[model samples]
Target: MNNISWRGIRAFLYVAEHGGFTAAAEVSGFSKANLSQLVTELEAALSVQLLYRTTRQLRLTEIGQGYYERCKIAMQQLDSAAEWASQSTDELRGEIRMNAVGGPVGEEVLAPLIIEFQRQHPGIRVDLDFSSIHVDLIASHYDLVMRMGELPDSTLIARRLHSVTTRYVASPEFVAENHEIAGPDDLKSLPLIRGSVDTWTLSKGKTRKTVHVAEGIKVTSGRVMRQAALAGLGVTRLADVYVQADLQQGRLTEVLPAWSEETQLTLVCPPLRHQLHRVRVLMEWLKAHFAERYQQALAEGPGQHFKSNLGAS
Candidate 1:
């Protein structure tokens, strides 16, 4: 036999099942003449007379009956396979590997949200890595990464989850002892707990200013910087999200609030085309969850310090 034609096989099956060329053509969208031609071609390919044709009617041969039965099963299986492949894309059933910083943003904010997300979507398994060191997403095959501050120009797609405003804060005891922090210039005189960056960028309305303060205690981690600030180890600029609770409880006092800098918290990932269904779902869930948490954090009292310009980009 020559190479089989699926088109001819489909036409033959339709004709045999529908009992006539006219009826089969109506259902299959093939013309009556085309249907007849396809059946003739199929018979020629098989080298057997599969149908008995006359002016009034048509009937399938015994061999044709057996062939139709087998073809029907094969076609049904093909349809099932196609359906399964399509459903795999729509259904959430995979693993998502993500990287984040090991601070309040990761442990206090994202970790709980991820746990809740996994509870909601039981099929998705999330692997979250927390470290201060940056990881190469493409090289490590990470599904996504959460980063703070200004994102450098790159091919990675960044979704701004929230805008983080930094406030220069100190313990109430420290502030009471060193009460010379009345303006931006006084920050230079006070003992400052410097993090990775030594310079502070502050903006008000249309005016922006940068101040280089003396570093009293140098730390690499934001959490440690915050802890140092909380322990009355001089003043430091920290994100409002990380210190909202402490500020509310009178543990820390906001100093020079008018000169705070606003940076962005972004979720960086590969392009949308490369993202799996579970990854997409998690991104959207994070956006919504973070937005709500951002609002709640602002609403929990000591409202004078925290700003509310939270939005997605």
Candidate 2:
């Protein structure tokens, strides 16, 4: 209806998407009473029952679902229009919500770059979510997500930042004990610091084989895996970037250098969000930053191990 407040529609949309008034309030910074009042106002204007609320759960009615579908589309268009209009202004002033892996990648890598970007573009703000949970870009309303390696099939755009070689490495003490190892098959018999995957695929030229890691120190974080490897816990597979200094200083020894696998770090963007100038700018900024590092690492020569395919499709 013409009298419907834009705020009311936005509040309603947030509640519907978040699946609860409490979640909507948390995300939208609206009080629960405020969200309820707005939704009530919206229902009064439209003269339709959009949501069924009970103590146990809240759900959209059939009519409400249809309305929500259309409203979602309209709101996305409105957001795009607002973004387009803002492009005319000299300063970029908005919030970019990003979902990324936490720990070293979030703190040591991305945090510094984001701080610098914000310094240069004073009007822009970043709301970076460092939750380790799986992310859905559109559903979660995230502007960007940083991910590593084998991405699942999705419609989102993934721009490569860098290609890093995965190395099977262990502490000097561990390597000393298992110095007889020479191939991918040797890894199966040794205790391994493993991630969630049960097997690791290694390639030497065109020859490839999958080694089953049955047991050992299990960890999810790359940083922890590195620590485990350094402690001589077991053999661990790590990206070159994580263990470069360790390899050079003899803290960790790379085993099966001939069987390393390559993985890429990428920034994923929703197609619609990628069209926005702010998101695109951030994407390019990250690409360029990583590109420079990749090049520098490459320039250090073969003795230094950086295999980057930055900006490569």
Candidate 3:
């Protein structure tokens, strides 16, 4: 019809849904004056009243209410049809939604692979969500999450993509200045950069031990903790894969020689229509990148090192 337009229809839907021009204008990225005029023109074209406008408020008339309900369904169908078309290809093409905590995984692991992925399949779009806190994928409408810690209870599928390996870490220079810690107990009375928890559970082979560490300085982010450890602030437990390069190069020393070290980095995906190609492509890309980066970190430090710290603890 003459009144039909993607922008106008979309804007009309937004205003009708929110019951106001200002909010709809915000959603449409249009000035309120412009939106008002557009709606006025739309009603004239349709020869019907869409909204009952007053000085204090606006309410949808019969036509506006009917338009809104149908528009929502139409928009959903439009999005699904677009998704279906995008996923028809075996190649990665479509938007891939992701969320991850800050680390080598986000900066180092996923970042590099995305360039290659876009090059191979130009139609693909990646929206990365990076934050320190865990995200609720379904509630937040995130399609996938690359998580480093325990997965929360949900219907989303989870995949183990990287080993959760942690190790003892301190710079060689720090050790020289602070006096070398011979074992876990030697950390007692040291200026410890404590984590959120007191017990540092370390494992190598069949042995697993949780060392009670007192907090001398406390903040999140292993990268910060590693820097603090290097500055001779105190001992901190770090993911072995994260600090492996330093261990091999004499940059970071493995404080305890015998401790079990293994944890998990998981790939999480929402259950709805998840067999899509973009999800499959990103998952494989992550698995390969993490494997490569993990090996490189293990090779960097002494018996172990940051950057080159390799293998399980």
Model 3, residue 280: C-alpha shift (Å):
1.7
TM-scores for the candidates: 0.61, 0.75, 0.65
| Between candidates 2 and 3, the TM-score winner | 2
Worst 10 residues of 3 by lDDT: 300-309
- For 1-313, candidate 2 gives per-residue lDDT tens digits of 6889999999999999999999999999999999999999999999999999999999999999998988887787678667776674455778889988665456546765788899988888998889878886655568899987778857889998877778889999998877577888888889999887778888877888998888687888887898899999999997676777788878889888878888778899888788777888888998889656544443442223212323342
Give the local distance difference test score of model 3.
0.70
Candidate 1: segments with Cα more than 4 A from true spot: 1-87, 135-139, 205-208, 272-274, 295-313
- Number of the top-ranking candidate, with lDDT as the measure: 2
Tens digits of per-residue lDDT for model 3 on 167-209?
7776676677776676666777576776677666656676655
Superposed by TM-score, candidate 3 places the C-alpha of residue 116 at a distance from the truth, in angstroms, of 1.6
lDDT of 1 by residue, 1-313 (tens): 3556888989998999899999999999999999888889888988888899999999999999888878876765564445445647767877788888766667656776898899999998999999677776544457789988877748887788988778889999999998668777787777899888889767788886677967588898777887898899999888787677788789899988888788788888865313456777898899989877665654452332223323221
Taking all chains together, the TM-score of candidate 2 against the true structure is 0.75
Alpha carbon RMSD to native, model 2 = 6.6
**How close to the true structure is residue 200 of candidate 1, measured as C-alpha lDDT?**
77
Q: For model 1, name the residue pairs that clash.
A: none
